[model samples]
Target: MQHEAKAARTVKEDRTDYLTEERYGHTAAHATMALTGTEWGVTTWNTRPRSVGRVTVCASNGPFAFQESISPVEARLIAQALLMAADDAEKAIDAAYVQDEVTA
Candidate 1:
């Protein structure tokens, strides 16, 4: 039997799907809470033959920050909900503006 030296190679690889400032999320106002204007970074990666895609959301600038690890499907659902909420908020704003103009 003979032994030979071999170069080291990475066995695991992580493919990042999102890592841009534009992909970051922001804090939104709620019924009883005010918006703190906190920017949240959304990162996602996929590992081969290990697990499904992961989505992480963390605050960029704030004393109170959080990190949540979720699946890609859950992330998509959250994105959809955000879009729907945003659309509703926009419509409400437009309606308020129209009412103000009528009163003025």
Candidate 2:
């Protein structure tokens, strides 16, 4: 097995920030993440055989992390689940904000 370091770059504009990294070769891999306020968007590429991907979600008080290596089909399922979960969470937060405004 051989080890290689990926190249990474960061960009910031106004209140938004972005970071991108790439390992550009036969086993090409890439990752990019962006942040604006409390929201984030992430994308990744895993071309190496039997590669594992990890995701960590955190809050001001603590962090939660998950990692796994699965078949390409399973990867799509997991990604869809995560997106739906995020959407549900955002809706819950919006509802809370509305309630707070009504009570205040």
Candidate 3:
């Protein structure tokens, strides 16, 4: 189940997914980090012909790939970023507390 859902969501399959260049190998590729907290998935691709001897580029190609295994370095970076965000959140909570005290 972990790999299944990650595979499904990692590839950003928009409406024109099939027609995208990444499908036909035309665009540079990249991946967005796992949103659902799991970075495991695959990207698929395909090619098609619109007219004889004519090639149309598909922007939708790519990210048909996912990070199957999270490295220790990446995991640590992620953890650090998360901790920073949490610290900011704690600061926000403290600010709210100060606001409440002022109001009282």
Per-residue error for 71 in candidate 3, Å, reads 0.6
Model 3 earns a TM-score of 0.35
List the global CA lDDT of all models: 0.55, 0.43, 0.39
Candidate 2, residues 1-104, lDDT tens digits: the string is 23333333332331111222333444222232224222222323334333334222222211533333355576578779989999999999999999999999
Best by TM-score: 1
lDDT of 1 by residue, 1-104 (tens): 12122222222256442323211243221111126555545555556544446766665445776778788789899999999999999999999999999999
TM-score of each: 0.61, 0.41, 0.35
Per-residue lDDT for 1-104 in model 3, tens only? Answer: 12211112223432122121222333313322445332222223223232322222222224533233334465467659989999999999999999999999
The count of residue-pair clashes in candidate 1 stands at 0
Residue runs of model 2 more than 4 Å from their true location after superposition:
1-67
lDDT minimum window of 10 residues, candidate 1: 25-34
The candidate that wins on lDDT is 1
